[model samples]
Target chain A: MTTRRGTEERIPLLLGVLASLAIALVAIPLVGLLVRVPWSNLGSLLTSDVVLDALRLSLISSIAAAALSTVLGVPLAWLLARRRFRGRRVVRAAVTLPMVLPPVVGGAALLFALGRRGVVGEPLDAITGIVLPFSLAGVIVANTFVAMPFLVLTVEGALTNSDRGVEAAAASLGASPLRVFWKVTLPAIAPSLRAGMVLAWARALGEFGATVTFAGNLQGRTQTLPLAVFVSLENDRNAALAMSLVMVAVSFAVLLGLRDRWWNNR
Target chain B: MCTAQRIVRRTGAVGVVLGVLSALVGCGTDSDSDTLIVFAASSLVDAFAEIGAAFEEQNAGADVMITTGGSSALRAQIIDGAPAAVFASANASTMDAVVEAGDTAAQPEVFARNRLEVVAPAGNAGGVSGLSDLARSDLFVGLCAAGVPCGDLSRDVLGEAGVTPSVDTDEPDARALLSKIVDGELDVGLVYATDAASAVDDVVAFATGVDMTTPYLIAPLDGAADPELAAAFVDFVTGPVGRAVLSDKGFAAP
Candidate 1:
C-alpha cells in the first residue's frame, strides 16, 4: 500500500515538471516579444497611415475570409463527418490539402486556377475583362483558400465526437434533414464552430506567403498586417516591433475569449 | 513523520536544481565559433554559395552559413540584430540602411550591376518588340512593386517612354513577376537581365529604351565575429573571379 501511494504521489510531481517545461517553452518567445518590442515608438507606429491601412485590410479580409470559409466549409464538414460515401476517406484527406501544402505553393496554385490566363480565369477574362491579381478581392480569395481547412477540420472533429443519436431522433420526428442539422447538430457544435472561426480568422490574419504570391503586395490594397510587418522590418525595426505587438495583443484577446469552453472542457 | 517529509523535500529540490542547471547550459552553448553566418540577397545565391564554400575550404575548422532572402528582408534581419558576419544587398539603398544604423565595418562597394529587361513567355504571342509595347491596352503586363529595385527601374523606363501601362499585377520581387511571365499569365514583365538569361527556355527579352541598371553592394557588419574573413570574401567578390561569374550570368560589370 505504501509503495502504491508513493507511485501515485510521484505522478502529480511528474506532471507538474512536464507542465512547467511546456509553459516555459511557449512563454519564452512571448516574453522576448514583449521585451524587445519598441515601446517608445508605440504611439507613432500605431498612427502610421500605412500601418493603419494594413491593419484595416487585415481585419476586413480575415473576417471576410472566415465568413466565406464558414459558409462553404460547414457543408463540406457535414458531408465528411455525417455522411459516409464512396472514397470518403480520400475526400477528407483532399479537403486538408491546403493545411499541409506550403502557403506559397497554394498561392501559386491559386494563380494557376484563377489568374488571367488560368483555366477558368481565361474564359472569365475573355467574357468580363476582370483580373483578380493585385486586387483586394484577390487577398480575400487567397486567405479563404488557405484558411478554409482550419474551419473544416475543427468542425469535422466536433461533429465526429458529437452524440449522433440526438440527430437521428430529430430526423425521425418528421424533422427534415436541414431542420435536424440547423436545430440539433449545429447547436451542439456551436462552441466548436466559434473556436474554428477564431482559428480561421487568426490564420487568415497572419497569412503572408499566399497573399504576397497571389494578391501581390500593393499597399492599401493587398498589404495585410503580416505583409506590413515584413515591409516594416526592412526599413524600421521599431515599427515592426510595434506592429507585431498589435498582432500579439489581438490574437491574445481572441484566444482568451474562446479559452473557457474551447480549452478547459477539451 | 518529520524525517520522511524532509527526505521527500530533499529529492524534490535536487530534481529542481538539475532541471535549472540543464536549462542554463542549453541557453549558454550558442557560441560564435560554431559557425560564421552570412546574410545575402537572393540575387547573389549562386555566387555567394560558391564563395562561401571556397572560404570554408581555405579556413580550416570553420563553417560558413548563408541565409538568402530578399535584400530588404536581409537588411531588416541584420538591423534586428541577427548574428551575421557579412551582408550583401541587391542594391545600394538596402546596404545604405545598414550603414546608417552604424552596423557596417566599412563602406559598401558596388560589386556588379544588373540591368532591367522586358521578358515575355517563350514564343511571344503578343509580338512585344520593345518597351512601348507594354503600354498597349490589349497586352497584360506584370511589374515588380515600387519597393523593389527592379520595379523602381522599370518605373524609370516607363516614365521615359511617357507611357502608362495597364499593369495587372505588381509582385514583391522580380522573380515573382518573371514567374508570372514564364507561366504565360502575363504578356510581359520587367525583370533583371540575369533572370531573363536564367529562364531562357521559358522567357525571352525585348529591348528597353531607358538604361535603368542597379548595382549590387556588399559590406561587413560592425563587430562581426570574423570581420577579417568577411572583408576578404567581399574583396574576392569585387575581384576578377567574381566579375567573370557575374558577367557569365549576364550581369554587367560594375
Candidate 2:
C-alpha cells in the first residue's frame, strides 16, 4: 500500500518533466532567434525595399489564398461529410493529398496543370493571351493548392461531429434547403470555419517551395516573406531572422485574435 | 479517471525515454575518424561526385561524403555547426563570407571560374540572337535572383552591355533558369557555360560577349574533424587530376 502511494505521488512529477521537455524543444529555437536578432540594425533592415515589398506580397497572396480555399473547401467538406457517392473515397483522398505531397512536387503538379503549354492552360493562353506561370496569380494558385487541405479537413471534422437533427427539423418546418443550411448548419460550424480559415492563412503565408517554383521570386512581384527569408539568408542572416520573426509575430497575432473573438462571443 | 492517469503516466515515461535516446544520437557519430564531410555548392554536384570517388580510390581507409546545395545554403549549414571538413563554394563572395565568419582554418584557393551564356530553346524558337534581344518587350526572360552568384554576374554583364531585359522571373539558381529555358517557358535566360554545355540538346547557347565571371573557392573549415584529410582533399581538387575532371565538366582554369 505504501509503494502504490509513492508511485502515484511520482507520476505527476514525471509527467511534468516530460511536458517541460516538449516545451523546451519548441522554446529553445525561439529563444535562439530572439538572442541573435540585430536590434540596432532592425530599423534599417525593416525599412529596406526588399523587406517591405515581400511583406506586402505575402499579405496579399496569403489572404487571397485563404479566401479562395474557404470558397472552394467548405462546399467540398460538406459534400465529403453529408453525401455518399461513388468515388467519394477517392475524391476525399485527393483533397487531402496536398497535405502529404512535398510542396515542390505540388508546385510541379500545378505547373503541369496550369503552365503555359499545359493541356488546359495552352488553350486558355492561346485564346486569352494570359499566362499563369511567373505571375502573382500563380502565387495565389500555388498557395491555395497547398493550403486548402487544412481548411477542408477541419470543417469536415466539425460537420461530421455535429448533430444533423437540427437541419432536418428546420427542413420539416417549411424551410428551404438553402435556408436551412444557412440558418442551422452554418451557424453550428462557425467556430471551426473561423479556425480553419486562420490555419489556412498561416500555412499560405509561410509557403515557400511552391511559390518559388511556380510564381518565381521577384521583389515587389511574387516574392513573399518566406521567399524573402530564403533570398536574404543568402546574403544577410540578420535580415532573414528579422523576416522570420515578423512572420511569427503576424501569425501569432492572427491566431490569438481569432481565439479571443471566438471565445468572447461564446 | 484513475485509468486515464495511468495512461498519461505511461506516455510520460515513453516520452522521457525517446528524448534521452535522441539526445544520445545527436552527439554521437558512428564514423569517428574515417569520414571526410565536404560541403559543396550545387553547381559542383557532378564534378565533386567524380572527385570524391577519385579521392577515395587514391586514399586508403578514408571515405569522402559530399553534401551539395546552393552556396549560401551550404554556408549557413556550416555556420550552424554542421560537421563538414571542407567547403567548396561556387563564388569568392561565398568563401569570403566564411572567412569573415572565421569558419576557415586555411586560406581559400580559387580552383575554377565560370562565365554566363545566354540559353534558349533548341533552334532558337524565340529568334533571340544576342543579349540586346533580351530587352524586347515581347520576349520572356528569366535571370537568377539578386544575391545569388549567377544573378549577380548576370546583373553585372547586363549593366556593362547597357541593357535591361524584361525579366519575368528571378530564379533561385542557374539550374532552375536553365530548366525554364529548356521547357520553352522562358524565351531566354543567363546561365553558366557549364550548364549550357550539359543541356546542349535541350538549350542552344549564344555568345553574348559578357565578360562577367565568378570563381570557385575551396577551403578546409576550422571545425573539421580530420584536418589532414581535408587538406589532402583540397590538394586533390587543385591538383592535375581535379583540373582534368573540371575541364571535362566545362569549367575554365582559374
Q: Which stretches of candidate 1 lie over 4 Å from their true place?
A: A1-18, A35-44, A127-130, A264-266, B1-37, B50-65, B125-129, B132-140, B155-168, B221-228
Which of the numbered candidates is closest to the native, going by highest DockQ? 2
> TM-score for every candidate vs. truth?
0.82, 0.90
Candidate 2 chain B: worst-modelled 10 consecutive residues by lDDT: B1-10
The digit string of per-residue lDDT tens for model 1 on B1-254 reads 11111111111123234323433444213342324556777666666667666665666544555666678866766776666677878888888889999999998998888888888899898888888788887787788766666767788889987878777666767777888889887898888888888889998897687867888888888856667777877777787766777788888888
Q: Candidate 2, residues B140-236: lDDT per residue as tens digits?
A: 8899888888888899999999998888888888887888788777889899999899898998898879777799999999987678889999999
Which portions of model 2 miss their true places by more than 4 Å?
A1-11, A260-266, B1-33
The CAPRI quality class of candidate 1 comes to: acceptable
Worst window of 10 by summed lDDT in candidate 1 chain A: A1-10
Per-model DockQ against the true two-chain complex? 0.34, 0.55
**Residue B63 in candidate 2 has what lDDT?**
57
Tens-digit lDDT track of model 1 for A6-112: 56666587889999999999999999989988787689888999889999999999999999999999999999998879999998898899899999999999988
